[model samples]
Target: MGVDGSDRGEGAGQLLADGEAQISLRQAEIAAAADALRAGGLVLLPTETVYGLGADAANPAAVAAIFEAKGRPRFNPLIAHVADLETAARIAQLDDRAYALARAFWPGPLTIVAPIRDANAVCDLARAGLDTVAIRVPGHPVSHAVLEAFGGAVVAPSANRSGRPSPTTFADAVAETGDKAAAALDGGPCAVGLESTVVSVLEGQPRLLRPGAVTRVQLQQIVGPLAEADDDAKRSPGRLALHYAPDAPVRINAKAPEAGEAYLAFGGGAGGERVFNLSPTGDLAEAAANLFSFLRAADRTKPSAIAVAPIPEDGLGEAINDRLRRAAGFIG
Candidate 1:
């Protein structure tokens, strides 16, 4: 359970005592959460990557509510979460590459962008009026259960305000979106704490738009070469130049801590008055999962500057660095 299950028990109980609107993330309440979505209400649920603020993808009003809740720009698109491949195929025009990628990476971290079929039920607001939709089938059981129960596409963006750190733990999900969301479900900390890797296939080439757990090497193994996105490449969710930022000023590729700066260490050998290590053992996957949480923690210190240790661009590190660069407000 999330808030209803001893997460900030005092606050939850006080809210309950006040008889305000609140719900739990326990197994028994999945149906209620589904019902909320079916009625055009917003819900925050766990995913393998991170918690997502979700609404029915086919509901334009619901989609607009998400934009309002997150303060997200209407120009950026949202990823539609589906229960299964058949559900995905019904909404997007998938090709051979798309099929191969789905077979290999569905139920995992990967969002495939493809043309929306004329028969697609997803509303235009969800797709930001684009002809394509970014869709994925998350592997988290809680997310899967919700999707299966809801029995339709859910457009879920990370459950945080726009340009803020994405919530990985259930506690943070509830903390960030408790008031705006109808309910926030806790499935535990996310396995892949970063967002999904987004690839665009609408241009007839598999272009790497955003990196994640599924590396370009792995995608190429199934779909041949993946190209770098162009300057004018169609924007998807999380494509902003100044995204995933924290309250403090962020500096990336720091070899050592600057005086008075809070340092986010990747591996061993980083020292600071305020420090949080992403991975002390030099494991990139672990670092990827720890990136945003550590940043959030470091930001809490109210440090003069948040300096991040250099992360190698290998495997999941590419995705981690992608987020870091964006958080640091570096586009190139």
Candidate 2:
């Protein structure tokens, strides 16, 4: 079934007779989807942060298939999604600091890398054969249900192909994975359209690997101040210079341009080559929610360049700036 639950038109209905290809509110349908995942099949499941293409983390072959399906780089590690603390501990070797952070942020948009003895057994591809495995317990009932029902950790990456925008809705997931996924459990749009903030705790000090819904401040409060990723670290995964970018070229400006450039502002602005207000009233949350959607829309114009007004470097604005900077190919 596709992400929308529509049959792939391959007569695979018999394989997923219990609402596999259709949006269903019933628990039985979710269970059926979970059953497919347990059988070493791919399932599109929802997380609070974004939709994920999930497979049993304990199965190396299954984990490798996820990389093959997404065309993701082998060096780019995958996160092990679990139902609870116990499940997360089973996959990764958690320290006291890791445990504290997990207890505080489990079922939320936070991922932590911890040392593992047999990374190959649980998920060789998930850790990329590294000593550490990134693990998290997502705060979505559908994801949790699927993981628990499968009775094991599930290796999940954003439900999109490599180097594409993450999918926030079931429709987007379908557009990304299509008939390849066994089933896409639509739990509704994600609250946080971005990915989880990944913090690596395997080392002596916590390091911020990636930023997302979980802010640096929030993480600081739980764990001590973290070392921001340097140039080398930023080159990893979705943090590449030209990543998370729209089809159009993007430019960032201090003030709204008068003409000749698309005026993307944080507040009021006149329309020109193109106009997109991150927030008409200067609301950061609103801007965050509208960022990707606007980027997707603006890309359709096929403009020569996209100009964006500067946003305050605080709160959600920080995350927005991070994405824009990367999109603009500014690694500095």
Candidate 3:
């Protein structure tokens, strides 16, 4: 097929097949994508969660390219993607606790930071010189295949530029990285639209750096009674007060009142407002999946602002609240 006439790149014009998994490629194309990574170019690849803009973590210039491409902040570190536990350990200094956690959650949406033994080998910027690196062993076949072919760790952040919604599909990735990325491997919509949960294991205690598909309770089950960071705790990379927010402001519904706000209810609408039943009948899983997409769509209406109904405080509700609280710009 002819490339699209868009300014994005040579293949920008190819028609996008809808809901089709045949977007799968030949082995040569995959190898070419891997070659791009080894040669210090960016490639947008799929993960079980979201698509990521990837470059060689060991090459500072390549890693910097990711920051530049995404317009990401220097303070916000990137996660290193590996194919397996052995590769993850090779890149980061893992302790026994970290090993135990990895054994339980290595091929899933959990990232752990461990000290870097050879910071020089990896881009100094990749670690932010903290002696630790955030690393994950992805479960997605395409990502694992590419990482294994590349024969080195790839530093990746969400394909979108800083402060934007993450890319869950190839088109979203291309829209974010433009022609700068060599290729974007489309692997269908991401199962989880959010980034991975990040934990710091460099310290003796496992600290929750960022919440993602892996819940705090799940982590505690793997380890034991993980400590929550204090409200006053200094923010780490990706833990900003107003992060993962849409362009429009968000408000949480503390109680059902008579009027004056759009409702994202547990189930059926209360009526007389632009109501979005996040999950009528209180289904948190459905609500979580719909959160970002709904936020994106709601922003289009350009409402004076958005108001969200309250969700339970436990389970996935914690994650929903966490995102909503940030969207509302609550510092505490």
TM-score of every prediction relative to native: 0.90, 0.84, 0.84
- Report the C-alpha displacement of residue 144, candidate 2, in angstroms: 1.8
Q: What is the per-residue lDDT of model 1 for residues 1-332, given as tens digits with 9 covering 90 to 100?
A: 42211111133234333322232334467897899999999999888788899999988999899999999999888999998889999999999889888878877788998989743578888888888889988777667778888999999999999999999988787777768888667777776788988888766568998888888888888888888878424557887888989999999999877877899998887655698989999998789788888889999899888999889988888998889999989873
Supply every candidate's count of residue pairs whose N, Cα or C atoms clash at under 3 angstroms.
0, 2, 7
Give lDDT for model 1. 0.81
lDDT by residue for model 2 (203-256), tens: 567888777667888788888988766532522346656666666677875475
| 1 versus 2: better lDDT goes to | 1
Clashes of 3: 7
**Each prediction's RMSD to truth:** 7.3, 7.4, 7.3
In model 1, the clashing pairs are none
**Predicted candidate 3 versus true structure: per-residue lDDT over 59-116, tens digit per residue:** 9999888888878878777788887788887777888889987877767677887778
Model 2 RMSD vs true structure: 7.4
Clashes of 2: 2
Compute the lDDT of residue 163 as modeled in candidate 2: 68
Q: What range of 10 consecutive residues in model 2 has the weakest lDDT sum?
A: 4-13
The model with the greater lDDT, 1 or 3, is 1
